[model samples]
Target: MEAVLPVEVEIPSMRVLAESKLKEAEWVKQCYEQLNFIDEKRLTALCHGQCYQQRMARTFNKKGRPREFSPGDLVLRKVLHIAPDSRGKFAYKYDGPFIIQEVFDGEAIILNDMDGNDDALPVNADALKKYYP
Candidate 1:
């Protein structure tokens, strides 16, 4: 008769298991630290972007002069486009020697034609300059 041999299974030692668990914990801690760093960097970048936008706006605004107009002022309106069919390139850039009939807050003005007829719509002072006739 042949004798049967029993098989033995190998198991990791407790020290090895403990070391692996410690390594996993350390890796998780490092990942959390990296996530925190990324979040802080994003927040800092957002603040910097906002500050840059505000600074640019301030600088641009500094270069612009406010247009002021009062009733009875003579002003010329900027001609954006004349009838396309007439005087294509030779058309004057500004149209009116219109009179300011009424002035409203925030640079809004009502204009009157030379014949003393009020314009149908209010015009922005920015679009009109002192005619200096």
Candidate 2:
């Protein structure tokens, strides 16, 4: 006489399966959070890039600044930004010496007239050259 045995398989319960699914969902949520952080970093970089171009144009292209001066400094201003029609003789001409009043964020320079009057105007640093008397 011979005896036969039936094959049996075991499977996890519903509770165990649900727990696995929860773990997977948590992992997916963590991945989404990381993606959000990356997106914010990219957005910040783009904003800075756009601003840098305008800043460079005002700073490097205008006067080709070598050195900068601070407030209440006596400096010469070479007016190259003046229109050609303004100066009948020349277009890229340097104006008489001026005194610096205040520097605004490396963009604008408030300075007095050639005679050092009280009236001050904000001009680009490139338009005015520092005068060392």
Candidate 3:
């Protein structure tokens, strides 16, 4: 009813500023792409180095002894427990010197105690280590 100040604000200047900022951002992005682009020699070297390291690591497994077990072989089973009240850091990393009762296709094995009771569950071969006295 009463005009104290100008009610209509100039909007075209704000739109023009926003469009100029968007164009500037696009130009900056193109400049960054040109500056930071990797050439063919560097790209090929990076990829070849990664692949060679992986292949070397895989082939280096021949240096370590592989885990294989038969029936009647003594082994130590890894016990993964998450007890909050444990005192030391090395509290019960492995449980027992369980005997391998049976081996199934190199995937899993049945374990038993010294008394020949099948009280433990079947464990994967990766979880068993040779129990050397």
Candidate 4:
């Protein structure tokens, strides 16, 4: 029996198909994100018509965040303070009056308002200090 050569598939169409699939993805996922969460009760209710209440997790007081912010919330940026001997060439210390660009459940804040330009500095909820009203 003679061995048959594998069939060559078109690559361009594959790329187009992949792009279409990406565009079809949910809006919440199109943007860069690592993880996402939703109300388990709501999901359960939708699936089984049951109501649920929120409860504190093990790290509630430690890691639990209970705040929210808008796109224009002013926040202070805190970075690691670098002592030449401790951090290296640059001092890794808290810097800035960077205004929060976007807030993710107040658990994370994106800052960049420096000289009127967005800088793409995202920080953990604990790292940023918001200006008190």
Candidate 5:
């Protein structure tokens, strides 16, 4: 009866236990640092939410609609088809009867396409559209 050793005999070496603890602590520290970094990045708040949506799109485009064009105007060219073999969303937006020719200033314009294509390019009077008839 003098040899009664009844108990869970878990014998972990002191050195091994200490090493394991150190490693675990290091891992935890690294994880914390990583998490902190991620939070900071997010905090940039997606770059101030894209600079507050570009300052609310420059204050709602300053109440838009200032599209001015001259030089033989006959606009109508806003068909930016985002093809997926498009023809959905009620297609036929507008596709030029162009023919501005030149009016660079308040909105730049120099379109031309009634088969009279003379290197047509510069166009931005809000994508043009004022060809009534």
Candidate 6:
């Protein structure tokens, strides 16, 4: 069997080479401009997101009243989840006439039972409401 040799490719002229180089430079410039445009778009999106978050926070905070509790205050602890063995909808929502033993920063509090036994962990102030006699 005889093997066929590949044909030689023609070299481009100087004029063609110069034209191709100009096109390449133009393409590079276009790519750089696109990159800059994308960066500007990303920065604008980030700023808009931050502004949206600030607006939402401001609106929410305007409607909210801060809960403040001090030591020796009687409060009721909200029951989170009902036991499976107990009554479902009929179960009591609030648990305690617990006394506020200690108050911490950020609305965290320690509670004491009626017998004066301190709770093991601190609870959020939102979970407790003032109990009146």
Better-scoring candidate (TM-score), 4 or 5: 4
Model 5, 11-98: lDDT tens per residue? 3333434544667776567557767788787979999999999999999998986666777767788876566777698777888787
Considering every candidate listed, which one attains the maximal lDDT?
6
Better of 3 and 4 by TM-score: 3
lDDT of 6: 0.83
| Candidate 6 lDDT over residue span 48-125, tens digit each | 999999999999999999878989999999998888887888889999899999999988899999999989999999
- All models, RMSD in angstroms: 14.3, 15.0, 13.1, 19.1, 16.1, 11.8
Runs in model 2 deviating more than 4 A are: 1-66, 81-92
lDDT of each: 0.79, 0.65, 0.74, 0.58, 0.71, 0.83
Q: Report clashes for each candidate as comma-separated counts.
A: 0, 3, 0, 5, 0, 0
Model 3: per-residue Cα lDDT over 1-133, one tens digit each: 3223332222223344354466777656655664565476589899999999999988897687776799999998887665888767768888688888899995789999877789567788888788987
Clashes counted in candidate 1 amount to 0
Model 3 reaches what TM-score against the true structure?
0.51
- Model 1 RMSD in Å is 14.3
Model 6 bad stretches (over 4 Å): 1-27
- Native-referenced Cα lDDT, model 2: 0.65
Winner on lDDT between 1 and 2 is 1
Residue-level lDDT for 50 in candidate 5: 96
- Candidate 2: clashing pairs of residues: 75-131, 76-130, 76-131
Error of 6 at 131 (Å): 1.3
Q: Per-residue alpha-carbon lDDT of model 1 for 3-119, expressed as tens digits? A: 323321123333443545657776567557767788888999999999999999999999998777878889999886688676878878898899999998887889999899889
